[model samples]
Target: MPRETPMDQPLISPAQRAVADAFERMFELSRAQPAPDLAARLDRLSRLRALVQDNESRFEAAISADFGHRSQVETAIAETLFVLVEIKHATKHLKKWMAPRRVATALQFMPAKNRLIPQPLGVVGIISPWNYPLQLTLAPAIGALAAGNRVMIKPSELVPRFSALLQELIAAKFDAGEITVTGIEDEIAKSFASLPFDHLIFTGSTRIGRLVAEAAGRNLTPLTLELGGKSPVIIDRSADLDEAAARVAYAKLLNAGQTCIAPDYVLLPEGKVQEFADKLDGRMRGMYGTNPDNSDYTSIVSDRHYARLEALAADAAAKGAKIVQLAKPDDPAWKAKRKFPPTLVVGATPDMTIMQEEIFGPLLPIVGCKDAGEALSWINRHDRPLALYWFGKDAAARDEVLARTVSGGVTINDCLFHFTQVNQPMGGIGASGTGAYHGEWGFNNLSKLKPVFYRSPFNRLADLYPPYGTKIARLQKMLRFMS
Candidate 1:
């Protein structure tokens, strides 16, 4: 057999080799300059802010193309403007977030002081999903850069136009070793996840999240997963039915209910199920009009997703479930545009497919609950959700729900607003995800909080050396007694 040279090694393909080389280069750069000053970090953030501000229209158009008919207003509010707010928040608080914190010293080390210094964790890898592509990709990158870490982002290939635009923008603005974006195929995505990164963050479906977790585990890499699940909303008896219905309609219809934190189901007071459904139906029609094709309603991402949603609704209807569709069933425009109308599924039981899975579409199941206690009990029976929403005026019921159920975050009297608070952390717990991010929480998660102990240069403890004398024993006895 012919000898194989180092350059001709066949362990990995050319594309994989290129990715490996990029990660290596970035890692080396991070080691050489571990700590970046506040000004430098601010400069990077400023550039990102400018990128969004300068090309707002381009982003709106690209994302609209990816989603068939994603609204310009929705794109601006949810993606471009949202990311700008994140950058501004990080820039405003970067100095305080980067400062070393003082900790109290113990009695055993009276003359010493303890401090916690936050340091960069080298290269960070982020795998963002297709839904809200720009926000998910850049939001986490904001934290990684704010923490003085190099970032390599792998955006979903499903949104090719947006991904290409993002790749172009990033490549033009940043050095490859500092910040880079990759839009590779499935096999390459797996290779990207398996890289030995200092940390990794993934935002997508629970199934894909599990795969990413397993790959990261092989390298023992720390991860922050923002997986989706059946996030429920409780509409208490005291809630203003009209107002709650309006807010829920707006939230569940945004991006056609393609958000991870979008309310997956609603628990209403048993007897008022019909009343609540009527209000929701009216509100959805008012917001988006009777024809989804003529309104700003976004289509399902692809035919496969549309088929899945159709099948779920069909299965529910076949199982004797009542479906309240807001649009005309005979409309051919919806079929051609791949737009599924806002649907409300009532009498949804545990055995139905719609109730079993996370409905990342415009399908909401209205589950009846006897009271607040029944609602809380039902929530506890399932996996922890990314978010929870409570709508009502009863402070006691709200407090009870907050204290009893566990979720990544909560928004009272509204939906999807908790995720916009830059000061608070946004992440999932248990099946939904792990590790929180956003604002200082994001900075802390990406950085290593190393503790330092500064000891005074004195010989007061010389008598306590390992001489095993009676005097030493007496000193030890005195210390123990004092403690």
Candidate 2:
């Protein structure tokens, strides 16, 4: 017989306590032992790689279950393969990244040498969203581990199936003190954010990011927020309509437009709105087909999310925007399966609700601008976006957009490709997000690069330290002249 637990005690405390215990153990170990050496870090990376490779099918299945019907190919490309690339990149570069860097000494301190040494922050906490659960959660963990910090993750409750599968798989490969995933209970998330982690990384909407920032702030925890905003696409007169339309349509429709960096709206020449919309509609239909049951298309995550997308379309319609649904949105088959039809809102104005918020679903609005200058002004007026896409052939026009606007990242003549570059840092600016992490940027972000200086015994710098003599005044005069 088992002893009964107290009914009045918080039911979620056990789950929260388990996470807290894991953090404590990891933190203590980080303090006691020197950061894991190169070989140990490599071993961890190898295990992580094997964990995904061996369980790829299961992960795809679980994520599909979470999304009602997530495309298997999308999972492979976006989630699993992406993580593998990150791990491989980090493994290949870890030694050079770990080595201390030489710093130039000042002329006055020429005899002394300076070095910047990278060391781990004790433990890192990751709060990941559901849209790309595996990729977002593990990408930062890869960076933290490469930098020699222990990791703890709290995945979104919306993807409970994937979250549970991740928790089990990670535990099998890693020690609790090395890396661990926590439960997705409401209380656990509340408790998880409040932990005094050495650093925190959150990927989600800006609204929730504020709450996480507030919690992390109380503990003075440094944070990397990967929040989303209304990322825009500019279609210049020089761009080929058919080519641009196909690329943008594919990008916008991927995972039902759940991606943070997906183009929120398109700005094209004033008169071409309808022409471009027809081209986009054709491309979207060609790729995903008219049936919502197409395996290539993914379902919206839940009924609530489905309804939200519908309301956005309806709201835009009410505001005099023409709503173009690729398939019938009211079809019982689509709604029963939680699939949201690909939609375009034409003649979208600034006053409409669709243009006001980050449209996280498969709804896109096409707004027209008088010229490149007007397009630039429109983007600058809002919160900086996480990503921007420009479609055109004119070098001067593209350069103008690049020079005038601010965004987390940009891709020319395409969408979502800049983020795939391992050499580039992935992050956002302003409300879109703050801080970047990818490849070496990630290793550097999670590290404490302490500067050390070696002093020469024969140097006369000590003579000017305390005594207010004539010699000190002469030295100070020379320093001022150098400054």
Candidate 3:
């Protein structure tokens, strides 16, 4: 097998001086209209399909080239098909999502009608991550479009090829001011954070999230931070061991464990840690093979990430944790491929770097817990993850974990399954994310609620006017105290 390699650096330099003048004036144009141009939006979506619909294989190849090992089927299935689905979903329910909702009218305002109108926030900035580039970027764009806001997107420079493809697609399909892909300078990312866009959505590490949030705050811009934490998967004694092993393997190893929602660590029942580890080892070999270079298993996104994982593994090893090599480190011939083995560390202490950090790689760590209760305590000690998975036959066990722990979402008996449901909310709590989007929730995230109160044209109820007398005051007091 050949040595793995990192993703190639961008051929196009991120603009240090972005064309802010055009973007600023575009913002002005948006403010003048203040309404979504749905017709223009439909045209763009139509063209998006035309641009890539027949060229699906090429898009998949572009992503695989960017990542060095993005599974072809998953790339097409996850990135392209999923975005297409989002487009269709947005197109169908967009009108309803944009419609004003009726609210209950109070007795004092009986002759008046109240509506909660969904309005578009002006311009939005989306900072997309390299992992799942197309899905993350396009999916959010769909939501923003449905919400009635024009947008500016900053695709992660890490996945340069895919980012380039997106820029080309947008430039050819839409007007630049409406939705242009600005390549972010390492500093431009921070500058974008400082912009006062009505809304910003960033998907990346919690470390960067802090900087983005702080910068966004300076300008009073609201943001949705899709940050990361160590998501955990627990294997209960009542669980089907084989099935649990398979699912856990799939969750953490998919996208080479680069998913923000990936299972960062695992809590296995005592006395079964070795068995689980052995099973996982064999399963990974079956999936990616004992040889990573030739295996369908993906490579790490970049050397920086590979080194981060290597340091974590080294740190854990130095601390006396047992290293379980599912596949030894990739061959040097594939060194430029950014390849690493699907490794696991056993007896991982809570203090280890691998346990503390989001292991966004093929490395998996197993910590032996006394029981499900102990597992919950272990997880409760850390920042809440975007997701949590517990496998068991006991209904009470499932409920206990769900009731005791706090996470963005939980998928009992399965891992990373929640994100597949397009209708479910996909943000975090505590640190993972504040808002969510996928289906209706995604549409809601990018929209604003503007309520309108209408008084009946022939209203004869003048009891609550400004010239209030004792009678009106008494009646108001009665209503206020009544319920």
Candidate 4:
């Protein structure tokens, strides 16, 4: 090859350039207007509400198209409704959340008041996953906007149709610098995390979360990783078998078990495994039906995910565990539609593949434990989960689990309900993920709560200032007396 000039070399891909331009534009605007007033923030929230409300039907259709077939009811309940609720909560409390609060000063600093002021962090970047695209993407944006910060979102490439629609909608509602959504290009995904955002929030698997964290670390960008792990459901002895089975079945089957907080496995009293498994299978079938074309059922995101779930089932089956699938896995109808059957892996052990990883599908493993202590030990032995569910009437057993093991959050008798509480924080701990955001927790996390102290000129504390004389001796004596 002949020697090439610097002009011959491509500096950046088109995707990277586009992302950089967007970031720089928003960063500049944020710098120019550091704090947005309550009215301005309210306007942004209102537009966001209008955007989703006006085109609910269109968004539902686009998301369904993207997923091959996402349930319309599920989309409405989980995605759009969740975002609207977050927006409503933030709007109602925006004025109060924006106000500076008074802080008490120490006795020595009397007449000097301290105030904690909440101000916007410049630019916030959100990297949302495809599982619940709309909710995960816009919920964080609501908080950042409520906190008066500019936002840029990078939606998952897996749902291109939905992502494109979201980008178009956002662009139409607000300026690119005010709130923007980027394309789902490979180059953009790689470079998006490298941008030095004032704060970045990522929602996805632990494997990808590590890479994102590494890239963000290079820019020292503060991150909130909403990652998933093998969260467990503990069926206490006092739990009503029928009630527990129904709740677990609904939770694990919703969105076809693509939820981050979905119950990955179950730990019930030893002898009750087979009975609970049977009940769970019945419940799953009753809710979604047996056919692949059931309207209430959701399809897997892709062929690869479908095959992975199959492999997990196969591995568990080959290792002496029994597989109870709601629909025949080999049926052409199921595979053709990309809908993996809801499965139960009974007699699952730690060595089984299904038990080793976070099954982001409809496959749920049921493992038996001797007692409550063994159940707690089993959970504590693994990585801390993002959410834990304990079903029972025994307060002691529930309290024991709560006090012993550490997880992101817990639901006493159900699943995923803790995440719906607007006042409670939603986040993970340890390997599951880190940091939290939801309602006020989100507002405070995304905002800079600066502490301001006003010094009083009238204070005579200066009397102890530099003159080493009888005054210093008197001060020493006074200090000794106080001590």
TM-score of 1: 0.95
Residue-wise C-alpha lDDT for candidate 3, range 47-77, written one tens digit per residue: 6666667667777888888888788877877
TM-score of each: 0.95, 0.96, 0.92, 0.96
lDDT of 1 by residue, 77-138 (tens): 99998999999999999999999999998776678789999999999999999999999999
lDDT, candidate 4, 112-134, per-residue tens: 89999999999999999999999
lDDT of 2 by residue, 50-82 (tens): 999999999999999999999999999999999
Question: What's the ranking of the predictions by TM-score, best on top?
Answer: 2, 4, 1, 3
Off by over 4 Å in 2: 1-12
lDDT of 4 at 448: 95
Candidate closer to the true structure by lDDT (higher is better), 3 or 4: 4
The total number of steric clashes, by the backbone 3 Å criterion, in model 2 comes to 0
Give the poorly placed runs of model 1, Cα more than 4 Å off.
1-12, 328-331, 459-464, 478-483
Q: Runs in model 4 with CA error above 4 Å?
A: 1-11, 468-483
RMSD to the true structure for each prediction, in A, is: 3.1, 4.1, 6.8, 3.9
